[model samples]
Target chain A: METPIEGIQWNSLGFSQTKTDFMVTSRFSTKIGRWEDLQVVQYGPVDVEPASAALNYGFSVFEGVKAFRSEDGSVQLFRPDMNAARFKQSAERMNMAAMDNELFIDAMCKVIAANSRFVPPCGEGALYLRPLLFASNCQLAAETEEFTFVVFASPTGNYFTSVDRGLRVLVTETYNRSAIDGVGFVKASGNYPATMLPKKLAIEKGFDDVLYTDSNESRFVEEASASNLFFVRDGKLYTPDTSRKTIHEGITRASLIYLARNELGMEVVDSEPLTVDMLKSAEEVFLSGTAIVIARVKSLTFENDADQEYKYPSYEVGKQLKEMLMDIQNGKRKAPSSWLIVDVPSLPVQDQ
Target chain B: MVQEGLYLESPREDLDWSSLRFSYTKCPSLVISDIDISDGADGAQWSAPRAIPHDPLKLEPSAGALNYGQTIFEGIKAFRHDDGSIHMFRIDENAKRLQRSAERILIPQVPEEIFVRAVKMCCVWNSSYVPPYDSGGALYLRPLVVATEPYLGVRSSKVFRLVVYATPVGPFFSKPEGLAVRLVTGFHRSYPNGVGSTKMGGNYAPCMQSMAEARQSGYDLVLYLDAKGRGLVEESTAANFFALVDGVLRTPSTHRKTILDGITCDSICYIARHVLGMKVVDDEDLPVELVRTAEQAFFTGTAVIVSPVKRIGHEADSEMAVICKSLDLAQELKVILTDIQFGRREAPEGWLTQVTPSDLEPLT
Candidate 1:
């Protein structure tokens, strides 16, 4: 018998498509009024109404979490429970139907075990997991209807380009990502489109992405187009307060704060309104997300009442934070007990 | 099972035209206008369009259109002339509006030429389904652009699919009567910062609950107040509202406001001012006081056309109301619009696009 694992380049893979064999799926049957049991099916398209609320009304919410190969031969998940909780919370805010935490965990386990072959070797890359929930029932009227939940996996390395190149961002107060009172805090799909035009304008000016300010005044920081934001200055951390405004309170951002305070014994300052001047004074500015865990910001150019520019010469804090978070994710260092969910069965591929 | 090209109309089909309702019926052919987008690019570049057989789209379960709510659409109507020729009403306006919607939400814009051609293709292929000349029904066309890329990131999709399908349906209001509406204050349908003017998918989904609630309370639909001002009347669930007081036509302003820039509302204003030489006033002020003096009120949309308002009621209690006894002007406007639509009267320049005949006659 010939070994089937040839001609695959795992480490060189960028953030792109590599369809896994199966996808775990579930549906919120408006009939039963709850998420159904997870089922592993071949990855393909599903039939839907042309007027499905997910399409016509933007009633879609989702979460992104990653899985990695541990030093031992066992598969692992890094706090998938957090992603599930966020998805449930987002679905609720969007008036979408969602599943319970237990069902979410069970589905993840089944999906990881089913696609264990695609999990890259240690230090190569991680399997990107995407959990999505959307309205499927089609009607012109505005009523909450049956929703569908699906999870698909892809093997990828970097979300952005080379990690060493870092990022150059433009801060535009001309447009706000989300209204201060809108659905920005939730992982609502509708919230992202508002950023595309701003990012496009910034790209024309030779910038990588755009950072939005508060909608009302454009004074305080909100978030980047793709991910939540974090700044380290004078040994203190700062991010937009999600409780008051529409900032995506990401799990990766949460983990870094956890490490800054408990692991490294640093005072983390956040939830207070953060100003651009404070960010300009910061030693290092970077992003935190499940995709590009941490990427330093080389420069920030902004125009609110007037034009301003800020540059940083160091990635010290961003590097340290990335190492600490990756250590916890990749099994190189011990994680806080609540941060890892590792009982997923690692079924051995006997065919090889 | 639907046969090839027979999905539109059948010669042996049993039909009742008078009782036809506004509904979804499968068209035999679907026209597509699309573009190809790649990573690290600023925007998409649309390519040549095509038409395919009508069927449920094969979408990747995690397509951005499904999970990210990346959808924008346009509604158009095609009327059959007395001589059996089809004339589509104001398709170019819908095309321009669709592009605006695409830009606001970052979906690929359908070029006006491609949009019109695609719409024409769908209308021609489904020509058999264009309700009879005097059925008082127009074949409703729905054109939608959706993100088709299979991805997990909460960003604009790299690929998009533009599809247009036709549904033969009767007029929104079959009789020469008026509708009952209520003023809703509880939930603001949209904000000044929100994407309300464009025909985006998110704009429609949130209003369903409000509309359903209004329907159960013995009202046709609910009118929303602007989120920014909270005093200005914006729009009803699916249409734009206009108040006719004395001799002037007044309604909410959509310029910087969050309300939709309704094409029907635009056409109505155009006809009133240019064709009929009537005074027209467009403002965002609350119509509360004017409701008492308004001789007649009506809704203007592609679906509703010019549906007169029988009365206006409070959101909390439908019993509290202001009633309009006559709909003379409303009926007059409807006749003029429908007359031009069905080709009983000549339309202004470029208002109609004739659907040239072809040999593919499925109905025969």
Candidate 2:
């Protein structure tokens, strides 16, 4: 077994980049019709053509996954297959070359194993894996002929710096995350930049993040800036329907829904439109994502009417679910064989 | 003026300039500048622009541009005058538009003077690439800005890099005389509160699929309707739309906040009113039905100067309207625009900025 790296303040880690040791990279071109030259190189800068579609036309997509160091000092990843499948969908939507799921998972494992020392000790934090794919040719037009795929790792702690008393979120009608028929459902790079301004404004007003609404009517709540929203009414759980194509199908959100139905025996409703009124009356509210495991919402304010606010009196549901989820992640509780990848495949001898 | 130690290279002699197509041909040099928001009081600490060799950029794998799409760009053209001098038309407008795009995406705006200087320096350093006055080709300048800070969070980067490069490109459309356009429904380019009007990289990639489908169906371009489903004409994949109806020139208003404020479109409206003495109708919603019955229609942009529309097809309705009975208006506008661009006719004040080549002596 590999030893944890020295000189890392794992306990003080935050949701920022802490460079690791190695990264995996590959290239694809229309001429070759397949990904090639896969290599595990030192983590650093990569050369990119100035006129490449990745730079000129914003042709990029990415995925996020985390690897945890369990109680026995063994490292395991959570739902890497889900991230691989979603990465493929995002790549296809942006007109980029999609990497095969097997190759994607293998690369993730190889990168994490190469940097096993960076994984925090049990209960400290996790090593976050980022898989990025983009068009990488020097072209002036919209179509791309060459592509690049990269997977890099960063050790990070909780996404929210302060979450003891829950978070104050603002409902925004001034800006929309994405259009109805746009790339909201996909984890395209283009979908995130537009939210920066809205998020910054919310923070200035003493809120943690902005909860976006649908671009068509601004009536139904879509999701937060970076994560998916979940509401608890009485004893039932409700979330916005991903079938509307305006909300991202988050892997964490799906896992929680599964746990809520199978483990907790709670009635989960996910196919309904989650409006502001429905959310205001919810007994509890929380967000879910790879970066933010689960965060409780204490209050919500509407942008149009600052006088209007909704406060949640209880966060018991979110706290209970976070513990259950973390237990499975840290290998303390039993999980489906497919959910936790305990035996990470070693790097190929030739590649190593 | 060319900086010391930054000598200009001779124009490339390998290709037939007359047969060049709308594509990227590498030049010798490009101008670049960088800004680090932390270094300044208001996040406006921009380094002095410098000319560098045309080479690939070194970026971290997790750069904001690569991860969150914090990228914006502008497209302008430079013409070779009859007197063997290169000049850029309405470059200031491009500089201003780029600033507006930067504001929408939260990137710190590059001051107009810096933007103009970088573009001019890039053009002058690559003056040889400008096509001959009669070759009907020009040097296309692409000014791009991207957030280079390597971060995982979804916020504007405190660091950005602005680059201005030149590429020799022929006319944008193969058929410069006229083009066949298709009106696409059910696919919206920009929503009311989205970043549609901004010339950011994110706005272009989403429309590639629609453009490719239109090409497969034998159409030169696709026209989009408003995202709100209001049935009002928006714009084409790359350019703005205009039509001539009952002796009046009409186009969509920029106030809708869903379409780009095209500089070429602005110029055409001015020419139509002052030069041609025709009634120009801007600031109104242009419905598709009105354009179908119009006498003529065309597209205007920096790349496509003025491409007359011959036919517009809507497959869902099986409607194919022949637009141009006489191409006199479009042809006239194109000639006037080209004349001013190529220095054949007198230009209005501040319309043209000549890239002085005295300091860019060819290498011995």
Report how far residue B10 has shifted in candidate 1, in Å.
8.3
For candidate 1, what is the lDDT? 0.75
Cα lDDT tens digits, model 2, B219-305, are: 899889887677789999679999899888999987857899999999999889988899999999998878878888899998788
- Backbone clashes, candidate 1: 5
Candidate 2 chain B weakest ten by summed lDDT = B1-10
Error (Å) of candidate 2 at residue A178 is 0.7
Clashing pairs in 1: A56-B201, A57-B201, A57-B202, A142-B208, A142-B209
Question: Interface-residue RMSD per candidate?
Answer: 2.7, 1.2
Expressed as tens digits, the lDDT of each residue in A1-352 for candidate 1 is 1111356687778766688877888888677877777788887887766657677678877888788887675667889889889988887666678678888877777777778778777666788887778788755443666888888888877443476467898887777666544567777777767777788788888888888777656678878987878888888877777875378889998998888888888888866888866777888888877778887888888775336668877887778888887877778888986675665774432221
Which predicted model would earn the best TM-score?
2
- Model 1: per-residue Cα lDDT over B21-140, one tens digit each: 786666678877667778534565565555688777778867878766788889999988777778899999999999888888887767787788777778877877888888888888
Identify the leading candidate in terms of lDDT: 2
Model 1 TM: 0.85
**CA displacement after TM-score superposition, residue A133 of candidate 2 (Å):** 0.8
